[model samples]
Target: MHKFHKSIFREYDIRGVVNETLYPTDAYHIGRRYGTLVDSRLGGKKICVGYDGRLSSPALAAELIRGLKDSGMDVVELGLGPTPMVYYSVFELDADGGIMITGSHNPPSHNGFKIMLGKDSLFGAEIAGLEKITEYKEGFGSVTKLNIKTRYIMRLLQDCIIEDGYKIGWDPGNGASGEIVQKLCKALPGKHFLINEKIDGKFPAHHPDPTIPENLEQLAELVSKNKLDVGFAFDGDGDRLGIIDEKGDIIWGDQLLAILAQEVLAENPGATIIADVKSSRLFEEEVSRLGGKPLIWKTGHSLIKTKMKEMQAPLAGEMSAHIFFADKYYGFDDGIYAALRFLNIMQNSGKTASELLRALPRYYSSLEYRIPCKESDKLKIISDLKNALKVKKASFSDIDGVRVNYEDSWWLLRASNTGNYLVARFEAKTEKKLAELEATLSGFLAEYGYFLEV
Candidate 1:
């Protein structure tokens, strides 16, 4: 029996700092356990594996592959590519399951595995179940190399409606998508300026997370210097995206979603659209105004994708830039595909990115804040905050967290599923109500012996 570190098995994925909390041994056990589980469910146990450009990934992947073969599962290796490419490989190769060795947007020192069983995302309790296995059955399984990047790129271009000539800047942040972006830019129309096209594990350019405004500075400058019509940025693994307008100003996830909604609704009226709880209320209003059904769901790429399938949503997005489209493609979060769709809207409408956004209503909002709290205490803190809100008889929705609705403002407090922290946001029509909401949230956290730096 192989022992596994409890911390490495997170709610969404298996993640930890390399060589410390997570090691090659942990990866091997994970592969062994997951392989055994999948082998029992499928007549054929062919699993596809891919890794990002991390310093430790190649070694970890080798060890994981050995364990998979030992546990009786055939392996289809997709050498090196983004996490989404691995997901595509599962579909392209018709494998029983897939695993992507990636750190996502985490720092270079951290790494993890994103898993899928068949087409279902392995998360939450399913990820935790890997640790309880005490039996190991070995069978003869094969290993093969499958490179689907050419086919994947073709698929990305299949549904793209490239219309007009516009200068665009693209930044891959030297993550796994770097080389793919180079290939994509060469095929797509327009004057494309590419940056960070070399995959470097150290991320010598900047942290590969596009959600942070600071990370987009390089792309923004490129847009300004080149007089580009728009700019696009991708997170480390290429499942998340960031956009910059013509003026070099950042177009946040909510605003980008709203703009894309306009294009989608124009073609398919009354289609259902989904967004996470952290999205702006104005985005929902805009969707309704465009004759689409708007839904607010929990934050997490896997959770959003599952909800989209359940509701038959043609489109869905999170405030963190995880956009899913079932309209003309597989319902999965793909940053490059989303960027292409945004280009289609711009070309078809003949409108600037800034002009398209000016049509939507705006509100005063706070940057997403992550406050430190022990993993053991985060859920309790959220529970205590919810109890306090209930006692106050506050109007709120507890679907994922406590999203309290006030007369002129709203605030959300939720425990992060991926990390040991409480995530929060506040929005209001006026600065006064914004401050009041912040104060109110601060008071609730104080009651739980935790403090939020608003």
Candidate 2:
């Protein structure tokens, strides 16, 4: 007999290293517990289950379904696909809730569960509540199969009028996205020059995440070599987007937010735009210049979604490329949908991608440099830095992390929600100003035995 442990259930979702802390028995228990959670809240007996491209995902999803079925909740297995595909199935099929077996952009050895309830992301106390049900788990239900990916592909294709003659570049990054990119492209009106199109959990082509500049190399090459219009890359589970322009410029998420913001404002003037605290300050400025309200809040996806609903914002995005669009589509992070929306924007403007971006005022910034710390010490390090930097002369904001605002530059240090790392970004009006900000923070960090590194 296996007993459910409390340590595995975490703040955002359930995660652990495969075969070490995570196992089929544990997954079965989680499914039962989660199924019971569903039964209590929604009273619907059906749940849509899905997974990613990892070798363990299929087995984990199967065991998860077994538990759900055992708990008397009807299980609709959608097999391997991106997280957004699972969300689409849950909504289209009218599932009570859904659980996606994906590690997201985590390391290869890690796997986790992302659960959705009644069309909302479950997190914080809601995610923690799973343990209470696991203590006395018994409810299990019926299981079935549905090839919903075809419907999903057709829907994406139908939603847009793509240019069939255009040559576009794609970097799937060997994640779950490759499994369906070709199928979905049939509806797309362009030729795809794909890089890392194979679905390999080992991530031989580079990590699936496109947010990092290094990961954009291959896709950038393809864009320049073939003279493609645009390039797009998917994260491990394909919820986040990474975009490269025809000029091979690796657009930051905030920059992309600005690009999409142009299209969004054209449709609805004076709408609210929400972005994470780590986002570029330029985004907020542009929002105002374009006649939209800008709101900066915390960084997590769950938090952003909740804030979006609370503020009734039409569009939201994070530095990680998790875009939520309540403007015309479901307000969830769908990288594929985001990519198409980018194209739609380009088509409407009749502007080349580079020309569109060139319209924005230029500013230089550093990549989000991660400072590694032990899981136990990360929080303390933040606290120490916060106390040390708090002075009568300095202005700071703590929306998520500490954002020190100087006269000519700013630096933000926030702990990552999904990993044991500190995310830092610095920007300035000039190279000299940026160096001053970096030097100041570097001194503070050095005293604590950790220094900022690019």
Q: Write the per-residue lDDT of candidate 1 for residues 274-309, one digit (tens) a residue.
A: 999999888888999999999999998888888998
lDDT of 2 at 373: 62
Which model scores highest in lDDT? 1
For residues 1-454, could you state the per-residue lDDT of candidate 2 as single tens digits?
4565545677678888888878878888888888778777877778888899887888888888888887788888888889999888877888788999999987788898988997888898998877666353356467788888888887666557556566888888999888678777766777888878788989998977788889999999999999999899999998899988999887788888888998888888999999998888888878999999999999988899889999888899999999888887778888888888888888888887787778775666777888876677777777876776774556888888798876656899888776777888898888888887788877877776777874
Error of 1 at 20 (Å): 0.7
Candidate 1 regions with alpha-carbon error over 4 angstroms: none
Q: Backbone collision count in every prediction? A: 0, 12
Worst 10 residues of 1 by lDDT: 133-142
Root mean square deviation (Cα) for candidate 2? 1.8
Q: All predictions: root-mean-square deviation over Cα?
A: 1.3, 1.8
Could you tell me the TM-score of candidate 1?
Answer: 0.97
